[model samples]
Target: MHVLVVDDEPALRQILSAAVGRGGYSVDEAAGVVEARAKLARGDVDVALCDIKMPDGSGIDLVRESRAANIDTAFIMVTAFASVETAVEALRAGAFDYIIKPVRNEEVLNRLAQIAALRGLRQENKALRRQVRERSPVYRFGSPGMLEVERLVRKVAPTTGTVLITGESGTGKGVIARLIHELSDRSERPFLSVNCAAIPEQLMESEFFGHTKGAFTGADRGRKGLLLEADGGALFLDEISELPLPMQTKLLNVIEDKGVRPVGSEQVRNVDVRIIVATNRVLPELVKEGRFREDLFFRLSMFQIEIPPLRERQADMRGLIRFLLLVHGNRNGTALDIDPEAEEVLLAYRWPGNVRELENVIQRACILAEDNYITVADLPSAIAAATSPRPVAGTSADAKSHLRDRLRNFEADILASAIEEAGGDRKLAAQALGISLSSLYRKLDEMGHA
Candidate 1:
């Protein structure tokens, strides 16, 4: 691994460079942020040790800038006891790690060693994905819900318009995202996905926008963020509603302007990439509750597609099972068979976690099956308890809950159709529905929408 040591103090810079060299890594030293930026622009450095305070500017600024520039280098901030608060700020801006000074050789060496090992695995995964991007996945495509999903994918995938896929978790949102990318003119380019909820709030901005080297505390190298990486193809932002309010504004600016400036960099780069985002949450409700941006919601919803939950499309279960079985079987080096009783149990279960949960169950069953046949014994406890061929008649309490769910779906569909017919004029929709505008507003509120 190549490492950069940036500190105003020449003695500390020399000490750190020698220590990293002894650890069997090439090392470079930068006296300040300006010198660090020059080294980072080359993009070969893998990690950097940056001081929080420097002559040119604060290290925090450098960290933010490096990430904005899309340099994939990791940064370790070197801070004094009095600068702990500033160190905290740097951590929020995307410093990989921070050390309190006077920095010791052992601590710095150990941290770099761990980062190098983890970075190796990350790079391997990226390379593997790139090598196989041409071999697209094949879907069984039997369920009406899934068929509609496929149809919608093909319908919108060919266009470069932004898309927002809304569905319950595990309904194959990622699969659909990839399908969109594959069908587009930019298919041969790159497809990148970022899970908004999975990233730390502090680092979200730097992750999306490339940063310049020495922009902040630990930023010793420049970075090209996800936006630039997906320049010629599609970028999927899953769980996008989880993005913080401040970042939401920045994202909206990018979507509207088609230009991005890295976290601390003054340069704006025009990018050409399709945006496909997904979320399981009810965004309208979130907007009403003041958690999501309303204008941004409208921008992303230009081509919206919602994938139905697994329970709603049980008709496709058989084909899904057969395909998943063959897949897991080949993977496990076994030809697996499911007994009639086991199939009954799978059919009866609600599958609250959708296709993803089903895949896990099937993989587990494949491992647990005896003599190549999977039985109820191999199923999860909840699913195993469900064996009746008929839908188990529920009690009065359950009936009310079930009826309420159906009514809600029915109402939402009616409202949506009416609004669409009126060309999205809610007042006209209300008149067409033979209801007062106030009544329509009340219904919308009750239905958890604006």
Candidate 2:
């Protein structure tokens, strides 16, 4: 906690500052109401010990002003005489508590302790609410690609390295980001996730680095911003490629310096945040095109993890389908089941939209299911039609072709689709197909596509 000692008398201010410092909190001094207001406007002080009567203005009025401006600092008024009316008036003006003058060190410490306890409770309540909101358990992967991803996550979670997760959209980058935070030493701190593409261009700096009160026309109150909120924890920046070049430079500075200067504030606050950025766009390509800063890209990509698209993780399909069914069923208070044929169709279909698309399909199937059973008919026509098995041709040429020949052609088609889905990265395609890179190359040569 950061405490502000606000009083006109130099001796009293020194006494209060010493008392607060002894309680193990960072202390700042303000000589009068104007100075206190200026310090509080920075939005860093957690508590203010203010004298009720000051030469320039009353602390009661300051409390009312801070409250009206939505500043979160808790005020503890100090009065020379403990009159009932004055105490009541301070409380009414939004002073958290009052301390009689000739303040005992123990009394001041006790009040500070109480305020700290309340703040802790509020933080706990926030954490509890987040836990309640996240109802789905993390899904374990069975595919080789996803297994490698899991290993990377485990390895990086224990360290403080900045992580960059790259993959196609909807490939669970956000999920992996959260998993890293959960597995980290700072799990109890915070895990703030935001989409870079979603933030407005003009407000990017203000939103990421925070701003003081009246920093802009609409910024009536100060903000702690995402970086400060995620101090001592991980911040997941999804769709990070969307950040403008200027913001990218600022982000790079924050990463390198471990400090952030809020909008319109000259003071730079130190922060300890583990940045985890994700993007479907190729950042290196953007750097080459001069759309992204090379320094920022290099900094973020020091430890990169790629999440394979759902089509690449065919081994995880059945488990994912079952998990989604269970999740949606439990959510809607229904006991849902999928027909064998329906499951086969789902397993064969290439989910271009990845896990997110699969979840939507499952949720829709659940809603359209009859007798709590999902069948082939419940699936979308496109998926069902695309994966429907075709009959063998009756032509003489087809019949003359050996079964091995037909199987080889089918395998070639599968390999080609996997390559396309893997964004033409043959190694990734080979990994997805559970084959060696050399074998993938050999197979392509055999099929005359080398």
Worst 10 residues of 2 by lDDT: 399-408
Give RMSD to native, each candidate: 19.8, 12.3
Give the alpha carbon lDDT tens digit for every residue of 165-214 in model 1.
99999988888888888788877676787799999988888889867666
Top TM-score prediction, candidate number: 2
**lDDT of candidate 2 over 73-161, digit per residue (tens):** 99999989789999999999999999898999999999999997777566546655775686357898899999999999999999999
Model 2 TM-score on a 0 to 1 scale: 0.75
Clashes of each: 29, 0
Give candidate 1's TM-score. 0.60
Model 1 regions lying over 4 Å from their true place: 1-136, 331-334, 386-450
Q: Using lDDT, give the best candidate's number.
A: 2
**Model 2: which residue pairs collide?**
none
Estimate the TM-score of every prediction: 0.60, 0.75
lDDT of 1 at 272: 67
